[model samples]
Target: MDLSSSTVVENTNDFRATSIPTTINGLRFYHELDEWQQDNHFIRSGYVKGTNSYKSSFNSLFYIHNETGNIYSHLLPSLVIAGSLVYYLKFQLPLYESHLQVWEWINFLQFGFAATFCLAMSSIFHCIKSHSHSVARFGNQLDYFGIIILITCSLISIMVFAYHREPKFKYGFSCLFLVLGSICTFLTLDPKFSTSVYRPIRSTMFILFGLSGVVPIVSAVNTYGLEVTKRKAGLNWLIWEGVLYISGAVLYAMRVPERFSHVEQDQASLLNNPMVGKFDIWGHSHQIFHVLVVIAAFCHWKGLVQCYHTMHQDMLA
Candidate 1:
């Protein structure tokens, strides 16, 4: 069937009215993951498989599909955050007293690099996952790489900049996490953990990596006192960041809050459980996870901003 340049029908009746075809151009959606995973579909609908070129795959952003939430969840943020970073940099150019040192601006750019790259790569993976198995796999690796960037960059900013007084510990743990992130990225790229059986293993790796931040947290508390650390170090903010991340990780691992009455869809009904199939286009755990990821990143950003203000106050004091 020729479905290229076709408008995505959001209504259930019209969507279902179109008879399912073996293959189509990259404008339709697929209901199941395997439909496109096994085929080079550009735009697979809820129940159909369709092929698409790179242009169509790129254009997939504007169309509605199950993957729309996943794509834009990170894609839009990527653009907005990047633009804001540039604008803020320019805004600070004329302030002599408020100006950051050269190294400080470097750190800011590095931090921005981590945030922007993670979001951008996430969008790329979700947008191009339908291109082919190779493309999807590449996207997954890019996603893993993005995760490493976020974690590593966050650690650098938190430990080094936030606790500039503790030079040894700051640089020490920063490198430690960077090395660990590199290792985890390698493991995730192995493709051995892509199967269902190894899914928990991959998730556990990420949790452990994030949990390693305790070293820095304890160091800060010990040096500054609990109350001072909480205020100056933005401990509460980081705690919220941790909470958001752990919550998202739990959802991704458990796939909760996803329910479907449509028992007929093969992938969503694997368990034959009626409570899990209704969330294909929305409310799926991955989508929820993506949203939480963004919020958590912002929480981290806010905490960093707080840290910067505290640093500034200290320098002036």
Candidate 2:
């Protein structure tokens, strides 16, 4: 068999006129991928190839590959949170003597839905990323939309709970976040800003969007006093949520753990194993980010619960 002839045949796209490889393979290395498929150089191996078809993309979910961790990390959490949210609203809420107000229920449900939606979108993006470039781009846009929704709902819910007694502040913050979220959604979904080259810009935009929460928080503190705001609003849990989210975002942006893949570890060296290619299937920065996002969402949910209890008790009194 002439290898040069085979290479020319594959390049010609004449074998049934497919874009690239028509055969489903075991795994591919970094060098084997097309430009659009290439991501995370530190993950040197374990790629699923020949997934241009939607059938093939969905089938890959059952198979072990580099994205398995990423797909399930958010997928499972999304399922769990969604189920719990439904159960709480349907069964648990009835047990309370004082039912949540209509607005409160709306905010709570919106937050839960947004959190689960974000995770589910992330899972879908990772799962379909091995498909054609266009499909992957669409999935990426869906993921960004979910992030924007989650951020907007999270801030709005927090502000509403914090300013439960102040209608003006609550309504103002809600409007502000909705407008900002719309702007973010536009930027994120834009084809030009969706590329790797604009990653820093995207990250900065999200960071700044999140930081805007500080303004409302400080305003609440000034209006209600620090101790009252902290207790009533569950500020401590919100702080932990912010810390976890920021830490995860920083790690994801910097590409930690896997970024050290270039480091060598000799037998006599302090390290147990060489860092290269070790995190290809698991323990990568993206996986860490997914876990942190889930944990942060949990913290936010718990804080909302705190606020709910306080509000009910205060109303009863």
Candidate 3:
């Protein structure tokens, strides 16, 4: 049988309609998608219709589609982070004379790996989702797992640097984040949680996990004073990181720009109207969200570098 056939087959075991592959010539509109392909109604065009073959799906990477921006926004950043990690480890990593140095190096690696993993997984997920329904579902799980890992590791890196002197706080918070990350991983593994129906729930879970960083921030302020905490913990950068993350999340949830593209009465104004479906090939909320996520990760990376310098200075003193 041909893999590119669009014929929908019913599997009696799972009771789901599966579409075989088809040679998709051009982009599809929102209304043209099958149930499995339906997502983001606000994106009314530029969809790569399901091909149900890995070869076909991967080949789409070279073409323009709604997913192109989302894929490259994170994909390119992952490469940059990976390269930075190698450079930092090779030249800047101090020879460990103490446990603090070791932990600092470890925390730095954690942050680097998490950021790269998250971005790469997101790119892969978006790249191959059109292969089939099962592939799409699996990709969604990988994406969620990557996100949780990134959130957990980012917090762990921050806590490690902030409380480098306080062994009790440092180890305590590190363990706390590990446990929390594990819990989140477990929670997201539920198949229902991965569905679009639970998108807000998934977002809330991640937001809450990220917000848990505030606990250590408050503790830092109480123990070391606000100014010292700000200097040691990179508070300003963290705040900016938080703002960027929250902004991205809100934009993704609200589906802005595209959502407003077809609003009545405002359609006459070309700028305000968003050119009616122009965002489909680019500038959609998901694409914006991906860009903001990269920025937020960069801010965290800067904070980590600052924290490393602070640790070096304190060790010298």
> For model 2, how does the per-residue alpha-carbon lDDT over 169-239 read when each residue is reduced to its tens digit?
98999899999999999887687776767766776787788878888889878988898778777889889
Q: Can you write out model 3's per-residue Cα lDDT over 129-163, one digit (the tens) per residue?
A: 88888888899889989998999899888877778
Order the candidates by TM-score, highest first — what do you get?
2, 3, 1
Clash count for candidate 3 is: 1
Task: Compare candidates 1 and 3 on lDDT and give the better one.
Answer: 3
**What does the lDDT read for residue 256 in candidate 2?**
81
Question: TM-score for each prediction?
Answer: 0.81, 0.87, 0.86
Q: Whole-model Cα lDDT per candidate?
A: 0.70, 0.80, 0.79
Best by TM-score: 2
What TM-score would you give candidate 3 relative to the actual structure?
Answer: 0.86
- lDDT tens string, model 1, 1-317? 23431322223324343533224333343434553363212223342133345666777666566678888999889888898778877785335345678877777788788989998999898888767667777888898789878988887887756777778887798889989988988788786555545656767788788888888888888888898787666788889888888888887776556522333333323344434335655667778888988898888877777777787777788
After superposition, candidate 2 runs with Cα above 4 Å error: 1-25, 263-273
Minimal lDDT window, size 10, model 3: 12-21
lDDT of 1 at 119: 87
